[model samples]
Target: MSTFTENAPGVAEQSPEAAAGFTLNHSMLRVKDPERSLHFYTHVFGMRLLRKLDFPEMQFTLYFLTRLLPEDSVPEDPDERTVWTFSQRGLLELTHNWGTEDDPDFAYHNGNDAPQGFGHICFSVPNLESATTWFEDMGVEFVKRPGTGKMPNIAFVKDPDGYWIEIVQPDLTAGLGR
Candidate 1:
């Protein structure tokens, strides 16, 4: 990895040059079951279904999810929606291969168990108490419940695929090193 510093070898110590702005389009997760993943993200994390793409020949499907702001609205026209969805940022992309979900023994490594690589994703909520209570009612899997982990203020929940997701309160994240 390359590091940019004010006092690196031949680099000047003066102010750095400005760069163009860019948005984080999306982060993808391959899912064995689209229905299960969609349910967890939309219901538990409060994300909206932005767009869906299906590749019949490739035997795969892609689902795009994003948390909708109060002021945001879904466009009705296909062209407009496509343009709008691609332009937005902070999206979670769920990809599903056609036959994987139905196979009893087939499963994707959720980056937590053996052969680990990726860690976990996060969601910041307005009220942690309310969110926990709701999750309790919904019977969601809890990898690390609130006030139980190292950070008593943060919580971790697991999706259907056993993917750990950290849940944080916006105001309390400061102590958790947001």
Candidate 2:
């Protein structure tokens, strides 16, 4: 019963200081199977499927996901391509462009864990140990364990498609200037 609105607030209304800070709103990924990726994200991370759009002409299916929370609500923005929003801390956008020319060679891996020109999406977790164990129990392969010396207690894990996800702790002391 969710609806899309064209009267959503602009960037200025959201955060005026971030207007010029080049903030990252969402990260898009091209997946071979939309349903498969959807299952991985929803089942493993407990993310809710906010909305899904089908473009018959373009042969594409866009899926939007967000962390579930009591205050989570969708925003309206007809001027932007953003399909959905969540009250969660961050946004996860899954793009499945179907019927296009074959993209069989698309791989999320870029050699090293952190490759130049490669972007890895990060998410904050309440407890690093619990999140790590949850993913491990779900058969997700981890790239590394939590490293303490770093700014944030971070651990890297790979998705079913081999995409990297940086799991970080929400402790403020773990970040810079602590």
Query: For each candidate, what is the lDDT?
Result: 0.85, 0.69
- Candidate 2 C-alpha lDDT tens digits along 1-178: 2233445556233334434434355567777767778889999888887667788887888787777678745555532324335323356778787843256666655434555566578888889888878887898888777755454367888876778888878783344553
TM-score between model 2 and native = 0.67
Q: How many residue-pair clashes does candidate 2 contain?
A: 0
Alpha-carbon lDDT of model 2:
0.69
Return the TM-score for each candidate structure.
0.85, 0.67
TM-score of 1: 0.85
Scored against the true structure, residue 135 in model 2 reaches a CA lDDT of 86
Q: Where does candidate 2 clash, by residue pair?
A: none
In model 2, the runs with Cα more than 4 Å from the true position are 1-24, 74-89, 99-115, 147-152, 172-178
**Residue 80 deviation, candidate 1, in Å?**
2.3
